[model samples]
Target: MELARWTLETDPAWNEPRIAAQIKLLILDALGVAIAARDAESSVRVGELIDELGGNPRCTVIGRKDKTSLLSAILMNGTQVRALDFNDVQYFIKEGKLSVAGHCSDNMPVVLACAEYLGAPGSRTMEAIAMAYEMFGRLRTLMPFVSPWDGTSVSGLIAAAIYGRLAGFDLVTQANALAMGAMRCSTPSIVRWGKLSEVKNLANALIAQSAVQTAMLAGRGVTGPLEVLNDRGGLHQVFDPALDFERLWAPVSEPPFIMTSNIKPYACIGTAQAAVEAALNLHPRVKDRLGEITRIVVTMADLPMIRKQQAEIHRQYPRSREAADHSFTFLPAVAMAEGALGDHQYRDRRWEHEDIVRLIELTQMEVSEDLARRAPGAMPARIAVTLADGTVLTEECLFDSGHSFPDRGLSPDAVISKFTAITAPFIPQGRSQRIRAAVENFETTEIASLMALLQ
Candidate 1:
């Protein structure tokens, strides 16, 4: 669809304080929200990564006793935050939808590190984040993401945006860095083993690191193509021929333009968000009727046969974190088996339960147009439980937890509880509280202070 006339250049204005304030709130909220999840696997991975990369006690790695360099801390912490896919998500409500949970995390590490390393103020850090986040959305629209491109195409742009903002690059320099980064980083496609590995969670870190590297290069008088997006072999033409420049730029000049976002309730793939809710809703009712359940028919609208069918493989037998997120069958199966869905429940030996296996095999998935309409983030599902006696218990969830609907926002307390619960296992109660407090009070605090708390 064509978008109204709007371009970043046509309506560029510098509003440092308001935009900086906005970035600060988002940073704290995302950090706090991620810390509050209840994913042991995520906590453990984060903890280990922190210990592996030792640094000066200058930076605090939340949910850990060890401190690290600002860069390492952000990298380790950001990756861990998203490791379980339980971090906050930013997406659209209807018509157009794209996700930016990890990408923001990408900017967090880069921006925070830049702030601490250069002793930049909180406003600068915020500007870095806002710029990177904006670039992430814009570049994604104009490029192909996570395909066979081994190196990050958009990642470098995000990095450049973040770094350029902090290093005080003007629009011209920033544009050049963006263009050069795009040209240098573009490739055929990268293996999307993200569906099957922790490496997927690390995608943000890699992107962030690349962004920083590119920005540093630009700061040092390095130059790249200025017409990166509009050039002969520019990103727009080469990356995604279907890209709608008009639509992308329509609100390109508007304030408060960043509207797409979602906070996750479950630590699984975007597609599994609705399934978890459906399974959870069915749990209390199915408790006593577990044995009576002869067949479970799960109907998901919008998802393809592959996504729905792949779940059976992982549900029956999961291989890795990547597999777990993509599995439509396993999440609900484990939820039904363990009474709830959490990181451990999926990776725990309890997944070997015979009843769960039987349930997974017996559980069937079907697609509906209604489900497809919910694609990209809101994955809607309907679960019909057929008892041996012919009784059927059915539950459907189109608006699940952490979906970010204005009328259906997840409880803020629940958001905090989730962050504390996830980080508690790795961090002491006192440290967890401190981290929570820092995030809660992120606006007033200095960016350095925030970085100090994480180290």
Candidate 2:
């Protein structure tokens, strides 16, 4: 309801240099992921869709030379950003409880798309990104219910706002854009459940495209329910009854929301990060004992373990790459067998490897109340390997690398390394370095140049 008013009026403390730096890192991290996934199946599929939906050329798709309509560009670029599932994630802290909001990078494509279309500078892009992150973070804290749709829906609204801002829409027009964006985009939770598909990665992209379309309509004088967020039977009533309107309308923070987010070091679901780390930690100890491993027990929080068990029938024989990547049993087993979990591990029928399948067949997941209690702050997990000699080795991962843990948070150099490695295949060494340098000095670089480097 008041989200529109707040979006128009709120003066987030973006003048701070520290916050500026964090925003830059977030954008760079997202771009790295997108560029790296240029050749991924999901990205290629979305590119084909863009071709099918031919429109006026306006924006460039990352890692591709083709330019398409604004909406098409957003869809293609957004899908690439999430194709590998290695983008950054937002961790919302409320009432001493921690909850994952969504991927902050989902908002980057919309911002970058709009900026490139308008020839806006990197500073403008950063400001738009900060706005999106602030809105997404605050909205997550306000929502009372947890649904997979929250990320895409919230991202749609933020994307609309960014598009409106770039188009020089007045407060009223921008608010209308938000209203329309919110009213139209309703993603389903099924995208993440059961046997996953390419749709899983494209959900956010669709919402973003819808947001841009709605914003374009609003900019041209179209109107929507102004109180879509809080009106009777509106978003609040339809999605979450426990919505915290007070906090949602409250003032913005000093450090900003991007600072609280975490980058993923591995290319898998966020929940599986800790488990994979735990499994990898135990990999060295059992490297020579694979033939002797009779059982591998993974204990994690109740909810995560339950979600993993939902696919018990397919854990050892995943029919799709998406399915294998999201499987708790499969991912840990892959970590143990390959010593790493990345794009390569999920390809070339690696999920069907004899050792991995054996490990998956031997693996068991159990709900640990202790681990559940430690969740939201620490995604705790324990992996125990029982060898043929009756010897058991156990290792626990409390905070995954690249997470926002006090000591484990990824440094700038580490982030750069990750970006470089992921995009190395698609982008040449010199070009990738130039892109990184531009992001490092993003405030002065124009978004057009940055987008060019990405292509």
Candidate 3:
């Protein structure tokens, strides 16, 4: 009731010109990344699973000419968004440590599927997306879960909020649905730990998939512990013990979190973006002297929270495609040696090159305490190359260019260029233009028509 009380009280959307512009860009970015990954191994495997487990076909899956049940469609589209590890990510600062609390756009598939099913217009979808962004930002900041407990633990609840608003669930029903979704979808964080498997991309998507049914049950008079929100044996028990419901539910007067999220210029983990920039910045400089280099040093933020699994020695030496993307050593080495970072660098087992492996061997990942304090706000990385002649050429990137800060974020034109570049190979110029127009003017466009463009 309290959540609904505030939900009904605050404006669902901050529909000014800039707000509309930013939301549309973020949506376009998510959709582009998803479309690029339509043929990923994760997508194919999940498609097979969808076929084996049959449901009514009524929803569209991005980049494919097929229909699926709402849940399967969400799973397929959500997995595509994350399959390449290149989706939009929102990081949070807690006690001066930058921690990734999962992606807000992971639930975009839920909103899109819901919009198609409800035959909702793009205006209504934008409103629901704004609500989902608001709730995710607050929970991610106030009482978010990090490593050891997957961020999807928080995302599932926000997915329910979007579902509730779009489906016209009453205050109590929506709130109860949030609780039910939370109770059911706290997946283990191990999926991202150590050597990552294909399942890593499917973790949050799995939560979104299950949320479709659980949220609907609440809408259909399925009762859950409403008090589970703050009372014992619920959020307080499973998530943060000292939960601050008031702060978490407080209305956000600042810009929506979508404005601060990073759209991921590189196809690697969020933390590795700075490393890519750092490596790329020094790539041209080191191109001629790469062989003369004796060592490559990457200065990174000292992240104690997530240091256990990723910082381990074996993690630095990637053994699989998933591991290569998350590998700090592999990323910088490949970028420095190849002068680029993207899905292409990882394909064909290019990281296995003896020269790249030699670079990885020469690479060392170091952390700076000062850098740690500035993280999540500014992801800083510095690359220092030590040549055999004792010459050092250094480059430092204070933040990834793709970050959505007002002062120096990625420009609208650049974002559009990125979308066009990545999805150009798969999508024709005409269809790409049509989708861009629809999303840019999304507040007035029809969801069904836009989805048809994607299909």
Candidate 4:
């Protein structure tokens, strides 16, 4: 019953039907995000690989043309889903800070891949998604006493559950899969601390890989330690210093839907949220005044954590993607000089423009207690542009366009358009349309039939 103590069975008020609906909606939303960001090289790499490895029709892998082996398909497609860190996120109330998000896409790819492997119907895909989300959410909610660890703690277990369900494993086998998956995948938090290596993008990929491996091992009747969650040397003791199991279980036991998920408009960390919005808003007005600014002050809610405040890594001049992604010092400075920030802005040599360097020289980010006291998902960044002639313009951004725009809260059409816009340049028009159509209407098609086209 330890598995029961850790998942859907633990929640007495659990609604199987509602959980299913939530999962279906989550997948749809996730696909929309993935499609929008598909053109990024990381995403393209995965998609192109899937397309080249055509196999028996089995599952719907987004942004690719062919059905591949389930394991390969999920690994590639799921990695694309998070290649840019621009997916939906849901947080648990227990820690108030420790949250879980698109790593669930790790579960989605594996689950859908299994659907292909079995030639299962959409109904089966839907059920697998629901169970995966519920089980994942439950594990995330249940473990608070462990930290210094990352969300992979929750992600791996959820992924394993998805893999097990798709592979026709029973409750015990599913539990074992989760145990082994977690054991293999858990890690320290430094992976995301400094620069924006492919590490953030690969976090979910690693967990998904572990999930698939665990499921395969379980299928062969392999058994792992069952006390993975409850053992004295288990996750909580090893990972989190301040553990609280009761509060973690309370929300899941009562089974309240933690649907307050936030979607990213910019592919960056939580700390950069407000600054990105502020720059996007002020860019239009300040474009003509690029050389006139005396000082650019970005007032954030809190002193950004260790990595974000690194002057040398980002402010001194970011040399790599990881540094650029986490550079609180660099993003606003670049936004000030260019009037906009896009995927190209991250890669282009334009980031080193003299004007941007000057802006970086002039820009300073300060912490405000009032701002920090505000709630999550409500990012508040204040930009005060002081001109050479002593004139000053100030703007505050509460939410970025894609995430907070009234009609733009991660809309499906918008996501589809984003996907097409980014990927069309790299893929053939016909292939792009085919992939988009399949992603948009996945429920109606056999996953394998759709996957076959990808190849």
TM-score for each predicted model, relative to the true structure: 0.79, 0.92, 0.94, 0.79
Model 2 over residues 1-455: C-alpha lDDT tens digits?
Answer: 46666665535466466667777777878988998888899888878888888989888888777789888998899899999888987666544545556787887898898998878777666777777888888766655544555356677687888888777778789889998898766777667666667887888888888988999999899998887776776776334646556666577754467666778888987767888998888788877778999998988765533444434666446878888877778888888876888899977867777887898889887767777676555556788889999999998887777666432234677688788888888778999889888888998998878888877
Candidate 2 achieves a global lDDT of 0.77
Clashes of each: 28, 0, 0, 21
Task: State the local distance difference test value for candidate 4.
Answer: 0.60
Q: Deviation in angstroms for 117 in model 2? A: 1.0
Q: Scored by CA lDDT, what does every candidate get?
A: 0.59, 0.77, 0.79, 0.60
Model 3 score (lDDT): 0.79
Top model by lDDT, which number?
3
Candidate 3: which pairs clash? Answer: none
- Rank by TM-score (best first): 3, 2, 4, 1
Better of 3 and 4 by TM-score: 3
Error of 4 at 283 (Å): 1.5
User: How well is each residue in 1-455 modelled by candidate 4, as lDDT tens digits?
Assistant: 34533443324333354443344445554654555456767777666665677655555556555445666666677776676665655444445542333245545667767777767776666656655655555555554533566566566666666666656677777677777876765756666654446666767776676667776797778988787666767775433424544443344443343233445556665456668778777888888988888898888755333223544454346666656766666788777666655567776655466777677778776766566466444455788989989998888765544442312234445445455555555567787677656654656767766555444
lDDT, candidate 3, 272-382, per-residue tens: 788799899888888887789898888887775546434666568888899889888889888888798877997788778888889988988787877766654766788
Best of the two (3, 4) by lDDT: 3
lDDT of 1 by residue, 127-206 (tens): 45555555556655554333345333556666666566566676666666666566545533333333355566666665
